[model samples]
Target: MTFSRVNAARGLTLAALLLAASGCGAKNTPADASRAEPDPLAKLQPAQDMAAYRAMSDLLYKLDQEAIQRELTETGQEKSTKPAKDKLFGFDATRAVHDRDFIASGEGKALADSLLTYQTPSGGWSKRTNMSTPRKPGQQFGTEKDYVPTFDNYATTTQFWVMANACNAHQDSRYCDSASRALSLILLAQYPNGGWPQSFPLRGKYHDDITFNDDAIANLLKVVGAAAEGDERLAFLSDGLKAQAKHSLVRALDMLVATQVEVDGEPTIWGAQHDDETLEPTSARAFEPVALATSESADLVLFLMTLKNPPENIRKAIDSANRWFEKHQIHGLRYRRGDELPALIPDDDADPLWARFYDIESDRPVFGDRDGQVYFELEKISAERRAGYGWYTERPYKALKEYRKWQQ
Candidate 1:
């Protein structure tokens, strides 16, 4: 059912308010508000975590800018790591672009410029390169996967909307031309049943399965809404995208609801990578559901509440999931996502095995595939995974422990 514009606007407002509460330093109630002193966060302006995020954004911006200027030589390469025409700028240079505070900074403009250059003749970018490079800090990661080529219609279509929006937000029109092309691509990619696949193969190879990838199409539809308001370039399909995103999200949400599992009273969401043929839910592959109260399940519920006009069912799910999280929160420098489990087989005198997933009602831990298999009985894993219980586990586990306290 389609929501009226007035109702949708109200829903969006409520969602924005919920999102604000989710950020950090939200007070519990107005009655408690009188006695409670304002948190430091409540008084301060929002700022990006400059040290880590800046360098990465800067590097990404510079690379994009160079690509836009046509300064690099293009060899029509098929691989992710194809060398640019110019001498490669060091990774440090790219990182420097992100050093600025705002996404609207000069570096951002440069990125918009670069993205503009890559739009294909068909109004979308083919897989010239992959954005993420899993490299050590200071190293430029390279991609070996060519999963998102222009020839792949769904991928290209989504990229077109993303690039267009990212560029438009920075007031750069260079990306406008590409955005128009992408609108054309979207019209071509839509399915008869109002679903979208990740790729569009021209040579009679049909690949259609709805998953998280479809979320990209949903987001693109919002962009198309903006395009239709006479922003030109890609204005043609703005109405189409808005309609499709609403239809697609509803379809996707139904599929997700059908896949949810309940353990005791708590609910868990499924991750992708289930058994395709049998449609069986697999272990935590990609955002797979876990029992309620565990950090995994609770966090999912918390995130879902931020959606505009969240359904009554979704609200109930979030409430149950969060109640479990609130009760089981570990308090201290050392904490686990949930209660720890005794190792089925001992590893050392002090080291006891633990499950990553926890049961809120039973007060037990849910082990993974490798939770008790004998190969690890004599073998040793890194301390990072065994953090909180181990003698020395500091980085993220410690940070997580601290954050949990704030949630309480």
Candidate 2:
């Protein structure tokens, strides 16, 4: 039977016991955790577009989350204790934490407990907090007075999925309750214009922008879209939540359509960030310019494609953006990093890669560095930044694939 309902009390108890028996209980004190050193991976910070790791940001997380689910069905075991070669987002990356098939196992219950420990009053999680790491045996995770919930760096997005998975692994009210709180947090964070800020309860600066950079808006839509669609993963959500999700998604869709950057009054793609009110392209980090963001807009297009029956305007939006991606695609270039510098080298056999940004006016590919200088030539940026950032990605191909399938 599908673990759709949130009635996992029996499962919860059983799982709780199993967790304790398995030495995964919440007994370790905060002092025990305090002594533990941070994982070395947590220290690896990118110089630019830290949240905009192209192949990652959201795609890799989405894929790897599914990959773990697929593996559980085949192997019927918990994830490997060994490290995953695959990249991760936020602090979970440091742990290579796989969202395993834990419904029947108590693993899901224990995991949900971990999530609950970290959840804030806003009903969401803060970014870069470890999701895979269990708190020391007895200490709560989010008791640190400063744990503010956010949508940045896969914050609320990751929580929703983890809770949803826990609910599915076994009916757990806490899991569903946490997820519902997250849903409300997400819903409340929306601007009237259908855009989402990077953080909720409103922090200043880029936090308030209509963010597509790092796929924050896209991830919000993914969960809200799932609930609106009455997806089984979120079957426990009430009809009211579903309706709220639907209405929110409908409004957000309009926001997306309205936010597309236009040239000559013809819709093109979108920018990484947009003004919350005016909806015009806005600058995010200095390296991220107010331009047609091929990456973010592409993900947004893919999100639109996921809708079952899109309105004409949405289909048109997808079509227009597809045209932009196809037009701006870079050929004969491959990015390869080595111990030596000059990471991106030309390869005659290289497949196509899309530039991260485009000049909204000139319609030419543009690159930027930490010093806030935008360059036309790929080689102009310093080597440290050139290697640290994702100036290119394979995301556009998904839009093309989805578009072709939609046509069919």
Candidate 3:
């Protein structure tokens, strides 16, 4: 099907399914009619805009429900599968292709070949898929419901790295061809302003936003930067591709500097995501609010510091972000992870910690819950979030340590 046609069909299907499930247009009994509950799908009215619709937590829950219902309808039983022996295809798998001998080995060849089968027409791999198993005919490229080719969770960039290394070791034209296609996706997905969306083909909502979450754009920059600098892993790239990579690298760096949040005309850190057009800090998941994100900002600063002889603007951006880190560092408290619940314990000699999110104007730490409520204290959130999320981090210390060396 044509892309546009497919999207339109998906919109119709989802809306029909969700509306029916939500009791929209359904006959109401006298008792039901008297009880007056708000429509559950009210937040999902803009279903035509896939990005916006997908960003709503309610819609996501509904999508999962639909998937389960479809599975039960088709098979009349719950689908069961064996647990994986080791980690499936993910960032770790991408990092595992480092040894040249391994890339040339028989096992490595098999893994690389499997990756080729999984590559979508968009020239990117999907996240959390099992590339160990070859793609079945007519199987969807993405394993996740409603997810297409994305850069999120170190997807395409990592696949490209594997392909490039495999090409280098095997001297295989097919590997080189695959690497080139992946490079094209990276180039095509970049916004005119030099930022990258979490997903390509413009999946709507925060996925359409220029994302720094989980080092999304940073990973893209690394791939292109290597290609531009003639890194041996990507040595198969043509002169034309290299030139394009160089241009992409320049634009991406410019976007990074431009997106740094400024409060009262003084530069600070950045949010995990930014609007593609406005470049303003934006929210992503329900628990992720529009605020200065310390972990992502720290990773960004570390990447920037790697550049040799940066311009004045880049230097200034780094310095200001470092100051913000220093000023906001939490003292006399250490975050302790417990079996039941995590807690912030008071300890005078505790290493400085940084909150995951901070108020843009006040610089005070903030917390978010699944209900979309913002809290000033970590204890105020749900137990699941407190136990599952990294509410406090020492990541800024690494950046600060690197910055000191960079200054010297």
- Name the top TM-score candidate: 3
lDDT of 1: 0.36
Cα lDDT for residue 132, candidate 3: 75
Quote the lDDT for 97 in model 2. 25
**Candidate 1 weakest ten by summed lDDT:** 38-47
Q: Regarding lDDT, does 2 or 3 come out ahead?
A: 3
TM-score of 3: 0.77
The alpha-carbon lDDT assigned to residue 391 of candidate 2 equals 78
RMSD of 1: 18.0
Which rank order by TM-score, best down to worst?
3, 2, 1
**Candidates' C-alpha lDDT:** 0.36, 0.65, 0.73
Residues 1-408, model 2: lDDT tens digits: 233223233334433433332231122232221112221211111112212222112221232233334334445655422221113322442121244544345655655666665554335666545545553322223322122456766666877887777766667676666687678768756775677877655556876788888888888999999999988888988787788889889989999889988899989998988997789989877777778877777788888888988999998999998987887777788877567664567888877788878888888778888889999877898887777777778688678777888778
Where is the poorest 10-residue window by lDDT in model 3? 26-35
Where does model 3 exceed 4 Å of error? 1-95, 346-350
**Runs in model 2 lying further than 4 Å from the true structure:** 1-100, 133-147
